[model samples]
Every structure is written in C-alpha cells, then in structure tokens.
Target: MPGPVMPDQAIGTSMRNKDRISAFLTLLPSIILIGIFVYGFIGNTFWISLSDWGGAAALAENPVKSYVGFANYLDLFTGFLGGGFRQDLVNAVFYSVMLLAGAIGIGLILAMLLDNKPRGESFFRTVFLYPMSLSFIVTGTIWRWMLAPQGGVNILPTYVGLPPLRFPWLSSTDAILLFNWQNLLPIALYLVSLVLIIWGLWRLKNNPAKALVLLIPGVVVGGSVWLWGDLLPQALFMEEIHGFNTATFGIIMATIWQYSGYTMALYLAGFTGISQDLRDAAMLDGASTAKYYRYIALPMVKPITISAIIILSHISLKMFDLIFAMTGPDNGQTGHPALNMYLTTFRANDFARGAAIAIILFIIAATFIIPYMISSYRQRRSR
Candidate 1:
C-alpha cells in the first residue's frame, strides 16, 4: 500500500497544475480574439455571400439580408451580368500559371548562377533582390509609365534609328489563343487527360506498369476529345472567345520582376544550405555542372520551389493593387477577380455578387494552399 503523500509534494503538484492553468489563461484571450476576428469574420462573409443583400439600399442601417442560396454564384457563372466576371476569372488563371512559371524558372536560374560564387556575388545578389524591396504600387506606377504606348520603352527604338513602337501595352482589347468559353466540358476533359499523361511520364521509370495504365486512358480520352470534341454538349448556346490578353503582358512582366527576386532569395538560401561535400563528391564522380544541378542540387531544393509556387500562385490570385495602379478599375483588358470584386461591391453596389466573387477567390486560393498544407502535415506525421 502507498503511504500518504507528503504535504510539500502535494503543494508542488498543485503549484504545477496552477502554472498550467495560468499558461492556458494567458493563451485564452489571444485564441478568443483570433477566433472572433479571423474565423468569425470568414463565417460572416460566407453567410453574406449566400444572401440577397445588395443594390441601392445595401448599405442602409438594418438592411435586409434574406438568404438567397446560390443565386449569386449561378448568376456570376452563367448570367448576362457575368461577362466581366468570367473574363476576369480567365485572366486570373492565366496570370497565376504564367507568373508561377516565369518567377520560379528565372529565380532558379539566378540561384544556380549565384551558387557558382562568381565575382561580386553579394553585389549581384543585392542587385537581383533590389526590386523586391519596392512596393507593388511603386513598381506598377513605374512600369505603367515605361509601358505607356507613346513613351518610355516604345521611344527607345527611335534612339536606335527605328520607328517608335505603337503597341498598346495595357489598353489593348485583343486576346490571342482564343477559345470558346462554352466548350468547358471538352476543355476540362482535355486538361484532365493532359494531367494523367504528365503523371504517367513522371512515373514511367519507377513503375512502368502503372505508367502504362495511366498513359493509355489519358491517350484514349485525350485523343478521342481532340478528334471528336464537336460531339460534346455546349456549356452555353452562345459562343464566347476567352484567351490571353496581351495587355496583361505588361502586368505579368512587372509582377515577375518584383517577385522573382524573392523566389531567388529562397532558392539561394536552399542552395547555400546544401553540403559542399556533396557537391564535391558529385564533381569527383565526373558530373558536369548542368548534371550536378539537374540531378543533385535541384532535387534537394524541391521544397523551396514548391513553397515559392504556393506563395506566388496565391499572390497572383489576389492581384488587385498592382493591376489597379497599372490600368485603374474595370479596364476589361487587365482586370482580375480581386479588382472586379472591389468594383462590384463598392463601386457598382452589387454586394451579393461581390461576396460571391470573394468566395470564388477564396476557394481558388484554398486549392493551392490546402494541398500544400496537407502535404506538410503528412510529412510531419511521417517524421
């Protein structure tokens, strides 16, 4: 049988419990504050998105906010009022893809070059990262001036005895690689097939049998769609051409210039963390510089690349300030959902529709973020 606990020992135990209680109390206020401000607001926004609350009297005290289900979402996706919304959605998708590719690719190249320890490495690194130090508003304003149709970059040609280029940088209404918006099903199928094919090729050497299984279905579905896409039902009776807006080129250029330095910094840190002994061993094994990076260094720093992608992709989704500064509001050619959401809510007084757009953006951003979060969580669990 156990003896009675000593009074001093009991006091010590009680003191530890009190300390734990005190620690929890210290955190409770912050947790409550965050819960209300962050999650509570998010819930309120989602509820507003599902309600009928907009128009002339939306801002009035005690305004009517009746639940309307998904009417706002349906209208944005299919109704006549959705034309600008759809166009902005397309632009946002294209922007995210292009920005991710350009920033990550360029940043990786710069990181690799810097890893070579060239002369004046610190100066060059500073020069590369200098753009990131400037605010997006400043960057956008500067680029807007440079890309103005009659001045800046256009006039540089005249200095070389050439005609001044008259290309419209941000005001052009033209779009290239046009596709019918009504063919969403066929396009989706094609995209799915392309993903499968890429997945198969990526795993070809590791598991040829599984690769063949994925590849065959992808090829069959993709080829069938390519050859007989006309058989598919149209999403809409009317034809709508949506494509890459050339005007966005100026915006994309400015975005890449501003963010690539950040990605470079991430990749540079990753490269620096790599053991020099490993690089020396690769060199001793007759690995060329290209092969050294391709086979060794790159694979080691893939996490940095993935992190950069997630950050940049979400940044692309919420691209409002730069676009607004560059082209102002509602310039269909350079509009994004974020800009459209602002105008719809504040300027156009379509609060419900704006809320829907915000929800859509939230979902899109989640698509990039949630997967990475799950991956990180699984990695942590495995460890």
Candidate 2:
C-alpha cells in the first residue's frame, strides 16, 4: 500500500545523518577539554577546601591533604585570628553598596545629559568611556599618586590659597557610624522592623490587607525591642565597633571614576534603544523631561539596571589587583577577600584556608548570580 522510496531520497536522509554525526564529532574535543579543565579544576578546589592542607607541608611537592569537614570555614568565621577576615568582609559589603550607588547614580545622570543631544556629544561620550579601557593597574597607579597625602590632592588646596588638607587619605584608621557587634541581634531586629514598616507604608494605598499584615508584626517587634532591648543576648563579651572606614574613601573614589563611565555607556545604549515615538508621545502628554525619564524611561530599562548591579557587585567582590596596586597587601581598610586569599595561600602557605576563602567568595558571587538566573528562567517559562 506504501509507495516505493526513491534512491535519491534515501541517499539525502543518510547524508543528513552523517553530517550531524560529523558536526558532533567536530565539537567533541572542545567539550571534553572544557569539562576536564574548568569544571575539573573547580571540583579539585572544592575538595581542597574541605581538606586539611596547609603550613609547611602545603609548600611541599608531595603535600598530604587529609579530609577535614568545614574546620577551615569555622575558623575563618569564629576564630580569633579571623578578625581580619571579618573586617575585610565588612569592607567588601560597604564597598559594593557604595560603588553600586555612586556608579549607577552618576551614570544615570550622565546618560540623561547625553540623551539630550548636547553639543560635541560624540567627543564627550568618547572621553567619558576612555577611562574604562585602561587596566586597573594603570588606574590604581595614577590614583595612588593623586591621593598621596603630601603630593597630589592635598596640595591642590594650597594652590587656591587655602590650608592643605592634613586628613589621611589612605592611612586613616577612623570609622564613623560605629556600632557594637555585640548588639547584632537587637540591630537585626530593629532593621527587620524598619523594613516591615516601610513595606507596609508602601503598600497601604493599593493593598490595605497586606499593609496591615506587615504593619502589625513590625509594630509588635519594634515595641518589644524598645521595651526589652537590654535583655537580648550579646554576640561578644566586649563591644566591637565596626563602621565605614575613611581610609577606603580614596580607593572608592578611584573605583567610581573608572566604572561610572562604563555604566553610563550601558545606560546610553538602553536610552538609545527606546523608541523616539514613545518620547514624542510623552512630550505631547505634557510630561516634563524629568517625569518622562522617571516614569517611563527608567521602568523600561530596569533590566539594564539589574545587569549593572550584578556586574558591579561581583567586580567589587573580586577587587584585588586595584587594592594591591594602590595600597598593597595587609591594609585592613582596603583588604578584600581576593587579596586575603592570595596572602593566605601564597604568603602564609595555607592552601586549605585559602581554598575556603575562595569557596566563600564563590558562594557570595553565586548568591547574586543564581537569583538572577532563576528569575530569568522563570520569565522565559512564563513567556
């Protein structure tokens, strides 16, 4: 009942199957190489992190690595010697937050200005983006000279017939907004209450039911904390003041200068992608420039904002070269996990502990990346 298959048709089908096999074979080597190199190394690193491999033995060619379950991690977090790591972690958090705020805010402003098609727009755009092309080493070296106590920025005030700034730019040890680490529990409770109250207020008009649900817990927690604040358990016997370090300001300034322009470019591209017709429509509707951008443009380019945050935050976490080039190693004010990891592994010959630090960093970075990945996946599924 079926028609006879033609030789040409059979030959064509065979050829296609062969082509697919050939194509797969062509890519097999690369896939195997990647699997062996990238994932293999990552797995080895994780194994090392879970082992006891350090000190003099770590530098030996035939180092003995014994399996130890999370001792290194525990030491880093709660050990007496880990004070530096804690301070470095705090610095990293502050750096990431400040860098994100400064870079995004400044970039948005620059993008808005350039969006108006001002005179010499191309030249200005090029100038702003030029800094991003420079390596961190170059940027750090330049900034180091500029931030020197007696040389660059401090002397500028003298040129204007004002007293030179004696304030320590890179060597200052003072911190502001200091809070005792012993009160972490109370502080955390207070922060939670504040967040709930803010969320309730935000939702009051549109979702009164949810607002009340949020507000009730917030009020109860806040009132409880106010009444029984002293009853909360202290995390430490002595008060440990940790706050924003003034010494990191110079590094922060240099980082902001280098990266803001890159964010500006991203925003500019986002702005360009927006249809002119939408702008015309907003204008016809009597929307001012500020309102148009605030209400329409920003909402449309939110993905770009999220991308910028993820990129900049990871960059902040991985900051070692710039910090090293600027301030060198062991400066608690500007020390990041990356630098600490290097010092631990190479300088101290503590391979296992270094591996633990690397894992912590990897986990922290994953915290930022994984959420975005899941959200993106969910969005795609929804579409």
Candidate 3:
C-alpha cells in the first residue's frame, strides 16, 4: 500500500463487492417468493378470519363492505350470530390428542423392535412401513372392507371355530373420552374406575369373570392351535363381543397404522447414521445390548426421536383423510374432528372460522415442532 497502491490491489476489493452483489441478485427471486407465498398468506388468512364475506362473491362485489370487524371472531368463539354454537372444537382437540399419543407410542415401539434385528426383521419393517406409502383414503377403503360390521372382521372368529365377534370401530357411538369415563372427566374418574376394576378383579378371582377377561386372548391362541392341527374348535357359540366402543378405537387404530412407519423410518435412519466406532467402543466397555442402546445409541439418536415426535404430532392434528375415510363424516353429527371442521366451514360459508380452526391446528403442530427446531438451530450455532 505504501509502495504504489496498485491497480491489482483495488481490483480485489472491487471484485469482492461484485461477487456479493451477484449473490444477492441470485437470491432475490427466492426472497420474493418466500415473502409473497408465506407471509402474504398468513396475513391474508388473519384478515379473512375477521371478515364476513359470503364466500368469494361478496369479496368481489363489495370488498369494502365485506369488512365485518371481529363479528366472525365473536361468533367463532361464542355463537354464529348468537345461533348457539357447537362446532366440534372439543372433539377436534380430543381426536388430535388421541392421534398424537397413538402415533408416537406405536412408532417408538416398532422402532425399538426394528433396531433389535430379529428374524425377518426387514420383512416386518416392510409390513410396518408400507402402510405409510398409501394415502389415508386408500387405507380407509381397505380397512373398511375388513372392519365392515357384517362382512369383514365379523366373520373371522366364526371361521376359526369361535363365537362371532364384531366391533364397529368406524361409525358408532363408541366414543372413548380420554378424560371422560362414564361421561365423567378422567381426571375426576380415573381413581374411581381403577379402584372399581381392581375390586372387580379381586372378586373375579373365584368366578367366571376371570375366564371372561381372558376370552379374547384365549380365542386367539385356540384359533392358532386349531388352524395348525385341524382340531375341533372347542370354543363355539362365543356370541360375545370384544373390544367394544368401536368408533373411538377404530380411528385410533387407523391413525396408529398410518404414522408408525414414518416414525420408525426416522429412527432407522438415525441409527444408521451413528458411527461404527462409537458402537464398538460401547461393546468393548462391557455393555449389554440393552445398556448399549439405552446409554450410547439412544443419546445419539435423541435428535431424530425429537424430530419424529414433531412430525407425528403435526400429522395427527390435521388428521382428516383417515377419519373421514374410516368413518363417514356425516354419521349422525357425532364428535369427529375432521368431519366437524368440514361441516362447520361448509354450512356457514365461514372461511374466517375455518381459518381460525386452521390456526388452532397450526398452533398445536407448532407446540411440538417449534421447540425442536429452535433447539436444533441453537445446537448448530454452538458448534
């Protein structure tokens, strides 16, 4: 610099600025895209939720007059024009919670088993994962045929030389209140029910009720034994129903089947990505399989496990296709989350309320996802 302040030295700084400008230019399109699509939609949705537009026609006809302040919001929370609302918001919360629990629980169990590497492990993995590939609509169709009250699952027990058993998991009043027992809140009723069941078991120790409780399991074993040996089906006239409360359980089962595979796949990849040396070191340190997985492998895979939770939680909230397909949404105006949302939106032509419901769903999904994403970002920054 003292010698000459040459052209080459100035050229370097000029080129750096040009490179920076070029990079900005390259990214400008994507920046504009994000601003319009993401930010615009969120803003517009919030605005729409405050209005009373009669679908889109009113939006075009009198855009200014379409403004209805928070009348839609008031109706949404209280009653639509004081019509006394019952929009199934409670049901949506119920199913969403059930779906969250079922998906995560089933997925974790399958992932742990898959990591164990039993015989036909790959085959079992495929069986579990394949369901996720199909759309819930397709899953609904398949399970419908199988769970059909008269035609499908109802015939299986009779064929196996047992009593006919039919459980209507899809379209019945078999609602299970997660918190509600005997229509009483679980928080209020659990101890009572637990005490009663325990008392019943104690009383049943010397009665036929002992055998009755084992009925379904016994039938399953007897069916297998008879099938293998061609023996007489000793368990006849089983005219008993098992797994009662079909509608509630049916939706739970469907949600579990759809999301379990996704969770397992996440675990699968997480396990695969761990370094071989770390595993070997744990083994050398006198670790049993269980200890090794719990201490060494599980800690390493915690991030993936958290990711699985967020994904499953989000999917569970918007659980429309599965519920709709499994149980027709119009089944007597019962409390089904998906059907409730759909009917509410269509009946009132209240896109605003629909958007409000959507925001609630978004918040639920964010409850799981946002925290995990933030933690992951902070971890990256520290490194």
Ranking by lDDT: 1, 2, 3
List candidate 1 segments past 4 Å from native: 1-23, 209-233
The candidates, ranked best first by TM-score, are 1, 2, 3
Taking all chains together, each candidate's TM-score versus the true structure is 0.92, 0.87, 0.70
Candidate 3 has what TM-score? Answer: 0.70
Candidate with better lDDT, 1 vs 3: 1
Query: Candidate 3 lDDT, tens digit per residue, 1-383?
Result: 46877799889989999999999999999999999998888778777767665554543545543567776655544442322222244455555566667776677677778776789999999999998999989987887777788877778888879987766656676533333111222222334444555655555657757645654444444454445433332221222111224365666667677777887888777877788788789889899878877878788888776777677666766667766776676653234444555765777565666666556566666778888889989999999
Q: How much does candidate 1 score in TM-score?
A: 0.92
Winner by TM-score: 1
Native-vs-model 2 lDDT? 0.90
Residue pairs clashing in model 1 are none
Candidate 1 per-residue lDDT, tens place, 240-297, comes to 7789999999999999999888899999999999999999999999999999999999
Clash statistics: count for each candidate = 0, 0, 3
What's the CA error at residue 378 for candidate 3, in Å? 1.7
Model 2 over residues 303-355: C-alpha lDDT tens digits?
99999999999999877988998999978887888899999999998989999
